[model samples]
Target: MQIVDRIRETFRENAAMLREIENKADAFFGKKNLQTSLMQSITMLTTRWVKMPVTP
Candidate 1:
């Protein structure tokens, strides 16, 4: 039960983070926004994204 709860919490946190990153990326690329390079944008986003375990 505890493991299940932990998994659920983690999932929720990841979802929120994704939304925030999307908004940030859009603002960084959208109209009247910073003209950051594509590599920089991807790197920034990928860095914060979860460093998850590999499951098969």
Candidate 2:
């Protein structure tokens, strides 16, 4: 359970980090490009998480 809790915490932190990244990207790339890039990044992250092996 501890491992599961830790993974959840990490994901929460990543969510916050992704928001921060989106802010910076919005400023740098503008909304349209940011949406596409951020969506791709999120898709890749989700795919990786789906493929990850977890034992608990």
lDDT of each: 0.80, 0.95
TM value for model 1: 0.52
Task: Quickly count the clashes in candidate 1.
Answer: 0
Residue 14 error, candidate 2, Å: 0.8
After superposition, the stretches of candidate 1 with alpha carbons farther than 4 Å from their true spots are 31-56
lDDT of 2 by residue, 1-56 (tens): 99999999999999999999988988899999878888999999999999999999
Worst 10 residues of 2 by lDDT: 29-38
Q: TM-score each candidate.
A: 0.52, 0.53
The candidate that achieves the highest lDDT relative to the unseen native structure: 2
- lDDT score, candidate 2: 0.95
Q: State the lDDT of candidate 1 residue by residue for 1-56, as single tens digits.
A: 99999999999999999999988888767834544566678888887675656689
lDDT of 1 at 15: 100
RMSD of each: 12.1, 12.0
Count of residue pairs whose backbone atoms collide, per candidate: 0, 0
